[model samples]
Target: MTCFGPRQQTAALQQAVPKTRVQTCNSTPVRADGEFVLYWMIAFRRTEWNFSLQRAVEWAVELRKPLVIFEPLRVGYRWASDRFHRFVVDGMADNASRIAAMKNRGVVYFPYVEPERGSGNGLLAALAERACVVVTDDFPSFFLPQMVAATATRLPVKLEQVDANGLLPLRATDRVFTTAFSFRSYLQQELPPHLAQFPQSNPLARIQLPAMKTLPGTITRRWKPVSKELLLGDVAELAAFSIDHSVGVVDQRGGATAARQRLQQFLERRLAHYSETANEPDEEARSGLSPYLHFGHISPHELFHELTSCECWSPARLARKSNGKREGWWGMSTGAETWLDQFVTWRELGYNMASHRDDYERYESLPDWARATLDKHARDRREHVYSLDEFSAASTRDPLWNAAQTQLLREGRIHNYMRMLWGKKILEWTASPRDALDVMIELNNRYALDGRNPNSYSGIFWCLGRYDRPWGPERHIVGTVRYMSSANTARKFSVDGYLSCYGEGTHR
Candidate 1:
């Protein structure tokens, strides 16, 4: 196995600094300064196995100063919703509870209610009065990139980001991946050496500082309180918002406990069929851990540790290999291997583009051929153009697309394959390729549990050929961009079953 030496160094630094993984600025906090640490909880919300959080812990321990975590959620951020808010509120509740255990280790939890709170001013900045540095989640795409860019310039203290989403931070990949195969090849060559060791936290035992004060009694009492105004809001008001509300706030649970349980369930039951059924929309075979992953409720390191801890691989044993070359252990099922590839290699590919490329979220950021094809097809005849409002309302005539939208509405997510088709249809039915891309992003970010994610951005771009190649003769609507039809999808998969489950012919 080719050693990902630099990656190993990055991992070590991440563990040592704790904030390195999530820090966007890439500078290490100056520990000798005796400044307290600020854990700017953004993308990665969980407290455990968080490189950013750990980095704060490191600073606290070294400087004998307090550590404070600030998590602010602003309203009107595109698809901000009750569902998303509830998930985050629950996570804040979780953080409050967990941080209580750390005592004087100093942790603060802030859950902002947007407009009412007014973009919630800087508790982090105030905390930085004595802060050694500020560390936040290192997300490439999404609104976060803009947030961090602005933050890096504004923060008086040094700003760093630690990546806790993908198994390997997207920046670890040297070049933008053109396809899954190329990305997969690189991951296969790199994962073994670096994936073996996980980041370890700086134990609390050494930091026997004063007990940290808990959240103010008022904040604790008001935690996740019901919103009477929201309950009273008109249906049209609710509908106008992009955020998903179908999965009631109660259904959208968050926090580390829920994230961990979800991961376990996937590995124990669903993983066995991952290879065979993950693509079957009706199966709902995916791990369902994505939202947690997206929210940083569970760490990638924690997930990998669980996988490696299973000594007796469920359903079999790995065959012993005598070859000098390092190969996968025998007895590992295809399902296990396949899912790992998605989790580590393919998913990381999205991160790679997001981190390295400025236009990662734009149509122009797609591969050269993809961009050319989309430009060529920009003026092609679109059979049925729909406005963003029409698409958001699920008013499109195509039942498959409607069904997919319904699934997204009710479940707070869509299945993986259906998700692909969802974006493709947006591309096909919109007046121009760019319009399709915009609609795809708007809709996906608004409803999907995994919306507003790097993957979602990459998925939308993929419909325009980000990680794919040219195929066949250029066609209208899609140009050289890949074409996917409801008919073709129907032929390949059982769309009827999915539609039936959500109730066909019902335009609600």
Candidate 2:
């Protein structure tokens, strides 16, 4: 490997990551004598549209070293289950195939699946010892932030984390907007430049570096790369691992392949009706891309590109002023505008909060008014109180709530509108507001494929009025915070097919 001086390394890094999207986790310098540049694929797992991978490629080319992509799955993380494991391994399988096809590109993809608790410990440090530098994903929510911070301090080489979470960089603004309207206003003013600076659509194709032929024997012998058989085999094999097999895999496959397919399906068949029918429980207007986004199998930039290309949209089409209105800002069709609101404003709102506040997921993180209102009605009599066990078992007296829970249990997801009613009902049925929050978090993170993500926290917190204003006519158990009812939900939308599809009897 060719050695690069500090100034050369710095210049390469600057070219690789934008100032707004890059962060040095530790003070260490890149190792000039090291064998390869390691791309630790944490949040952004796909080969395409990834800033972290692009950064690694840049470092590798600059230093004349091969690139090593390490994507690992630990069995010890909270809520690790057959469902998440299978979904992630499916992606690993896809990545393995993709990288194999690019063998001439001088990249090595290593996917490691921990067979038991704590089995994969120290693997990253081992890889870092031989790497010129480590480039990884910069994600704010869940265990990723802490994990990266801890790993950076222990590694021998410099560690750089790149923000590829969304269209707007995580560090773009320090202020956390309280509502979607406010976030939309901020984005309308600040997001245009970011729209123009997307990660390379196919970064691997452009990567030109020496191929890493082998891994160190010590690291390879102990923490072996996951087998092709395991990745492509029946998900039933996941039971052998020390993870929760109770949360089984859903019907949907995971990875960039499936994510793109779902995106195309939504664009061709459902996007036009998205504005009108997205809230209807029986309609297939919702884009089923949350799981893919959560797992980093797809990039928001890629989705944005596809959408913009379809509409012939560009930064020049953006509104001249920020009025906090959702539809006009994008200068796209009504459906595209509506979808962009959810995709950019609402989804990135969670990222904004998580990036700014360490307590984003805590019950204490609720807005002052929401907490005050919820606390005021804490002791008010509840019509019914259900234990976590009963809730998890989908034995609630409310058929609609049971259906939602059943859907979550069976499919790892719920209808968009039904999920709101689901959380609100949980709040209504639980003993206290805090208890309600606890139940929602437990149920959601345990089953939903998209759980433990910033967006997931946003949705869960929204139930307790995190990003909402107080409603009028204070009510018992919910107080001034918004209230939802099964009867009213029934009146608002036809859930007959939803009920039949995920009714209590269908629960396993």
Candidate 3:
């Protein structure tokens, strides 16, 4: 069928864009008769700017079949917790609300948790039995890719995956780079033409499905409820779930509403200072939207749409010179463009690595230079070799590292820059590079709200020498993994001042 209006952003065209583009593979399933369309909502969570959702809707209408959006939350996966569970349930709640309001066009079924063990189950098999086609979110790294591979192989029907996370999908890149410069250059060239038109979501016109008799409870209520009176008690109980229960979920909350509010607040209050303060751990410089992005609560496409409409970066238009009454701003402000660059370029760069590289989560994925340099100093005597216990307890002698750890422990996240420094210090304090990598992953995946994401893995890999170059003469602990010393951070910024804000046990 000829789909029209604005051109649909396909994964192929998206990949052709230079920057982080979201592209649809040729394998993307089409909606047809005698088959229902299934949108396996594994990644992109929101209803807006969602190409995958658009694809699912288009196919559903084409086939005149109802669409099913299935999001299964398995409990025993790595780093599963009440915190993450609550965040996911929040998004599920949002999905239910929106889909329900859409009549019977779409149905979101979470199954109250995955019945299988890991991401390696054949859940899609049953869903796709009579499916016109099955479409899933194309994520590069983590268990998502592996799961996709396994599911695709087992499916009896047509299977397609759509790239919706990055502004430009990593498939667009000709090759991976050791730094962001190459990726940035590519994206800058392709963004204008590709990102010019935002793809519109056409919900299924009319389809009959089961009625929404039961409304999913709110996240706060469903997850055992965290009240002002029970905050301490809830935290204490939640802490018992894991070894490092020190980290607690914040009131920032999760889901579409929270994500939208955070974005609005960032655009209004923080966008002006994003470039300057993003690195400062103490300042709320970031939009704090990564978790939402990771969970698919907010569609990157929607964000791109909103960003393009903003005064700072709206597309230029023809000028009417009669009385100088009508014209496009010759020079659009770069704020939105700058943020978009970060969103698509840098963010997807990480996803590209995670998606394509098998060893993304493993230490061996470090660049050749990083590995070589690290091995050169493999036997370098460590100043302090604390056990994971000591490290986990924040008993390190370095007050700076301790403070960073405490912040992550209390807030479930850390300042973006401080996180890098935090990982580097762990590398230095541990006995071996492998051990350091292990420790970093363990602590991060366990605590940070944004942990276990592509960015999280990419950040850890960066500390262990991915997407970076070896610097200077061989150093002791860091090897080639890009040495980031506390002294260097102190010189680079006010380390003492930064740490003072997230001092030990300081939770607001």
The numbered model that scores best in lDDT is 2
What lDDT does each candidate get? 0.67, 0.87, 0.65
Worst 10 residues of 1 by lDDT: 318-327
User: What's the residue-level lDDT of 460 in candidate 3?
Assistant: 87
**Considering TM-score, where higher is better, how would the candidates rank from best to worst?**
2, 1, 3
Shift of residue 51 alpha carbon in model 3, Å: 1.4
**Where does candidate 1 stray beyond 4 Å?**
1-35, 101-119, 201-207, 214-250, 311-331, 505-508
Q: Please list all clashing residue pairs in model 2, or write none if there are none.
A: none
Backbone atom clashes (below 3 Å) for every candidate: 23, 0, 20
**What tens-digit string does per-residue lDDT give for candidate 2 at 177-294?**
9998888888888987776577776677756787667787888899999976788858767878999988988888999899999999998888888899889885468888999999
lDDT score for residue 105 of model 2: 50
**TM-score, one value per model:** 0.83, 0.96, 0.80
Candidate 3, superposed: residue stretches over 4 Å from native: 1-35, 105-111, 115-124, 201-248, 312-338, 479-481, 495-501, 505-508
C-alpha RMSD of each candidate structure in angstroms: 5.9, 5.2, 7.5
Angstrom error of the Cα, residue 219, model 1: value is 12
Local lDDT at 20 for model 2 = 87
Per-residue accuracy of model 1 over 1-508 as CA lDDT, tens digit each: 2233334434554446422244447344464564456777888887776767766677666666666677766665666777677677667667766765755445554544443333345544555555677778777767888888776776677777776666665555578777777776666555453453455532332455434555445444544322343323223333433454554543557788888887888888888778788888644488787888888778777776566444233212333332222225323557767777777666777778777888777777777777777777778777788888888777888888888887777777877888888888888888887888888887787777677777887788888887777878777767766788889998888777788776455543
- Candidate 3 lDDT by residue in tens digits, 183-301: 56655555555554444443333545433333235421343222232222244434334322334456657789889888888878877666667676545577888888888888776
